[model samples]
Target: MMDGGRGQVNVALEVLADLNINIPVCGMVKDDKHKTRGLIYDNIEVPIKSGSQCMHLVTRIQDEVHRFAITYHRTLRDKRTLYSILEEIPKIGEKRRRELLKKFGSIENIKNATYEELLATPAMDGKAAQSIIEYFKQTSEA
Candidate 1:
């Protein structure tokens, strides 16, 4: 079962059909206020009782899927942002950026690290460590 209206459900059904998967596909169609109105199957609108166990289950599933999607996107965005910030530091490339993040866990930790601490990380040398220290110093000042 999917959480959407006719148009969304129809596309999913077509994709499944193309894959030769024969299974009953139903859509939890929502009304104008975004509440589930009925289940659409075989082009039929089957009303579900309000506050019923089935309705509760469908609502929970939809909420869970939305929450998971948001969390996943936020994680990806944070990683991209972190990498971009690291790239601004001279002498730091992809491999060194990865190693620093792996060792320090987060940008905040890397920023707080002492020159000796940054130098101790694998694949990091004096130049890279100094660049990181200087980059954070400049960003903090700005």
Candidate 2:
């Protein structure tokens, strides 16, 4: 299933077909009034009656999926922002960032961690730990 306008739904279907995912795709789209219009299947718009059980189910599903997608995107954005700071430090790539996040849970915890504690994290070395320490110190000072 999908959620978007006609163009978006069509493109998604095409991409799914390209990936060899053989499944029927339907879109939960909204009308000009910002209301749940209905399911768009096989390039046809199937309008659902307002206040019907089917409408309630479709609206609930669409609302839930939208909320989930937004939350997921926000998390990725926050992680990117946090990891971008780490990227500036030498020897800190995707693997090291992941390791640090796994160990400390958040950038604030990593910042507050001691040099020795940083080194104790999996895949961390003395030099990387020192760099992290210095990065936080420099930022805090500035």
Candidate 3:
């Protein structure tokens, strides 16, 4: 059972079909008020009794799915934001950015690192290390 409505269910069905997996897929649909209303399978709506155990379970599942999706998206967004910051450094491309991240774990660590520490990172050169140091310095100043 999916936590979303027709759109999500259809997309999931299509993906499963592509993988040669045939299984019944149903969606726990919400009403206009954003409350779970019923299940939808093959465009048929099966109304769920409000305040019933079934309804409560569906609500729990939907809440958990939404929470998980939000967390995953936030993590991806943070990674992208960090990588873009690294991209701003003149001599830091994908490889050097990756190396810096691997060595320091976070941008805060990289920014706090000394020039020698940055240069010691694998795939990092003196120019790239200097670029990172200068970039962080400028950003901090602004």
By TM-score, the best candidate is: 3
- Cα lDDT tens digits, model 1, 1-142, are 8887788888998999999988988888888898997899988889988999988888898899999999999999999999999999999999999999999999999999999999999999999999999999999999
What lDDT is reached at residue 75 by model 1? 98
When summed lDDT is taken over every stretch of 10 residues in candidate 1, the lowest stretch is 1-10
lDDT (0 to 1) per candidate: 0.92, 0.88, 0.91
Q: Which residue pairs show collisions in model 3?
A: none
Model 3, span 43-117: residue lDDT tens: 788999999999888888888988999999999999999998888889888998888888899999999999999
- Candidate 3 Cα deviation (angstroms), residue 125: 0.8
Worst 10 residues of 3 by lDDT: 57-66
Question: Which candidate comes out best when scored by lDDT?
Answer: 1
Give TM-scores for every candidate, taking all chains together and pairing residue i with residue i: 0.79, 0.74, 0.82
lDDT of 2 by residue, 1-142 (tens): 7777678889997898899998888887788897877888888889899999999898788889989999999999998898888889887888899999999999999999998899999999999999998888999999
Per-residue lDDT value at 21 in model 2:
93
lDDT, residue 11, model 2: 92
